[model samples]
Target: MTKKIEVLGSGCARCKQTTKVMEMAVKELGIDAVVEKVEDINEIVNRGVMATPAVAINGKIVFSGKIPSLEEAKALLSKS
Candidate 1:
């Protein structure tokens, strides 16, 4: 199954970096994943995230506020 990963933020550098990190993690792990950037503030807030650069996998948040490590992201993706 393809994992659905989303980076939620206001299209800031940190948000972009989060997406890139997730991409690299998936590539390195050879996992089938779909990564997306969500710049919608409403959506981000609705998810109970008070900070940018939050990561969601399969509709459940795995990380927020800070950039996650490759290993952390890969683990989240694996669950999806």
Candidate 2:
């Protein structure tokens, strides 16, 4: 199954960094996944994320409030 991964933030540096990490992890793992950036405040709040730079895998929030390391992202992707 293809994983639906979302990076939520306001297009800031942290958010971009998270997106990059997620993309690299997906590429390295050779996983079928769609990574998207959620910049809309309403959407982010509706998703129940109180912090920016959050990560959601398959519609479930996995990480939030900080940028994750490459290995951390890889592990998250692997689980998905």
Candidate 3:
């Protein structure tokens, strides 16, 4: 299945960085996935994310509150 990856934040630098990290991880891992940026506060809240720079994989949160390292993101995607 194609992995649905979301980086949720307020479009800040951290959020952008997190998105880039996820994209790079996806590229390096060579997996079928898509990285999306979720900046709407309502959507973030709806997802139950209380922090910025959160990562959701296949509609389930896997990381939050900070930018994940490349290795961490790769591992997360691998699991998805």
**Top candidate by lDDT:** 2
| Candidate 3 lDDT score relative to the true structure | 0.93
What TM-score would each prediction reach against the true structure?
Answer: 0.91, 0.96, 0.96
**In what order do the candidates fall by lDDT, top score first?**
2, 3, 1
The TM-score, computed over Cα atoms with residue i paired to residue i, of candidate 1 is: 0.91
Question: Which should have the higher TM-score, number 1 or number 3?
Answer: 3
Listing every candidate in turn, what is its Cα RMSD in Å to the true structure after a full C-alpha superposition?
A: 1.1, 0.7, 0.7
The residue-by-residue lDDT of candidate 3 on 1-80, one tens digit each, is: 78899999999999999999999999998898989999999999998999888999999999999899999999898887
lDDT of each: 0.88, 0.95, 0.93
Summed backbone clashes in each candidate are 0, 0, 0
lDDT of each residue in 1-80, candidate 2, tens digit only: 88999999999999999999999999999999999999999999999999889999999999999999999999998876
Worst 10 residues of 1 by lDDT: 71-80
